[model samples]
Target: MIGQILINGLLNGFVYALVAVGLSLTWGVMDIVNFAHGEFLLWGMYAAFWIWSLVGLDPLISLPIIVVLIFALGVLTYLIVIRRVLKVSGLTALLATFGLSMVLKNLTQFFWTANYKNITNPLVSNKSFKVLGMYIRQDYVVAAVGALLLTMLVMAFMNKTKTGVAIKATSMNKQAAQLMGIDTSRIYAITFGLSGACVGAAAALMASFTPIYPEACALYSTLAFVIVALGGFGNIKGALYAGLIIGVAEALGGYLIGTSYKYLVVFLIYLIVIQIRPRGLFGW
Candidate 1:
């Protein structure tokens, strides 16, 4: 039972890592807290659902489409909302994102009616297979693997590519980067888009088993905030490790204590860690 729980926790940790990576990018790069991050995830799930429902495409098959669409959404958001407020105070950007979050949630509810829709008979089966004396869900395995691959891809991009280096440069010192001839505005838009892409991929992966609703990503978003903070702002490796720690803690907490108190355990661990290392595990 413990092994199974650990396996489950690890699988979930991978997905959580992906989600936090997205938030980390925007926060680290632009110093902007996107309160609408969860809503962006909600939209991705919706896009997958509508495509499957209307066009008979499986969530897995429609994954690329959903990702690209959400990437566009992120760019549009930066261009339309974030850019205008970039020169303003951080609080103004925060309020703007908060308002945007409200608008997005309401718009989703207005159109989808708060109904919990789901993909039926997805390409990835929802069955569990026994592995090394533990049962593992197939869909979850797929999601976990996808999340891991995507996270690695993001890390590689950051380390290997010219554009990615520019992004990092901008994140480290925007004024310096600007002086070096990097277009800070374009980089910001791209960062936002990349953020959305991460969540969009996560949404696609989760949509197979998760119920699609406006509030579906609510808990995820909240947890992501904790994950990003616990991991330290702008620390991708921190986010990844912190997510795994949270996932394990949540699983063990649920098993040892009660399901109702799982999140309590999560926060308690965060508090303890923060007291020990105020900047987080990987924060400099």
Candidate 2:
């Protein structure tokens, strides 16, 4: 039972990490608290759903398209909306994203209604395999693996490439990066796009097993924000580790206490961690 709980928690953590890392990256570079980040995930889910429904493509096979589409949307958002607010007060920026969030959510509802939707015949849906006396859902395993790969790829992109270095430099000190001839605007756009892509990948994986709806992103988004705070805002690596921790905590808490109290346990951990380290587990 313990092992099973651990496995479930760990797998869930990978998905949470995938959701949080994008927010961390955007925060790291632009210092923008994007309230609309979850909408990107929602759109990605719809993209997968429609592609499957209309084109007969599997979510797994359509992942790249979803990523690209979301990336484009992110870049466009930066160019059109976020850029206009860059020079304004932080509160204005926050409100701008908050507005965007509401608009996206409402638009989705207007178009699709509030009905819950799911892939009826996803390739990995409802499949399970037994391992070490525990049955694990195949969709969860696949999503976990996909999330891990995406996280590693993002890490490598930030750590190894020249553009990645420039992004890191920009995040550390935008003025210094500008002095060094890095186009700050371009970097910001790229960061948002990359963030969108990360969320897109997560959405595709999640859509395989989870239901979809106009407001479906709400719970996941709230959890992602919590993960980002617990991990340390602007710290991608921290978010990764924190996500795993939260996942395990939620699983254990749900099993030991009650499913209804799972989030209570998570927030309690967050409160304790913040008291000990105000900047998060790794904010510096």
**lDDT (tens digit, per residue) of candidate 2 on 1-284:** 98899889999999999999998888766788889999999999999999999998988999999999999988987898899899987588888889999998999999988988888888887677899998798889999999999999998999999888999999889899999999999999999999999999999999978789988889788888888888888788888899899999999999999999988899999999999988899888
Candidate 1 lands at a TM-score of 0.98
- Predicted candidate 1 versus true structure: per-residue lDDT over 153-234, tens digit per residue: 9989988999899999999999999999999999999999999999999999999899998889999998888898899988
Candidate 1 Cα outliers beyond 4 Å, as residue runs: none
State the C-alpha lDDT per candidate.
Answer: 0.92, 0.90
RMSD of each: 0.9, 1.0
Measured by TM-score, how close is model 2 to the native structure?
A: 0.97
Of the candidates shown, which would achieve the greatest lDDT relative to the real structure?
Answer: 1
Residue 226, candidate 1: C-alpha displacement in angstroms: 1.0
Candidate 2 C-alpha RMSD relative to the actual structure:
1.0
The worst-scoring run of ten residues by lDDT in candidate 1 lies at 81-90
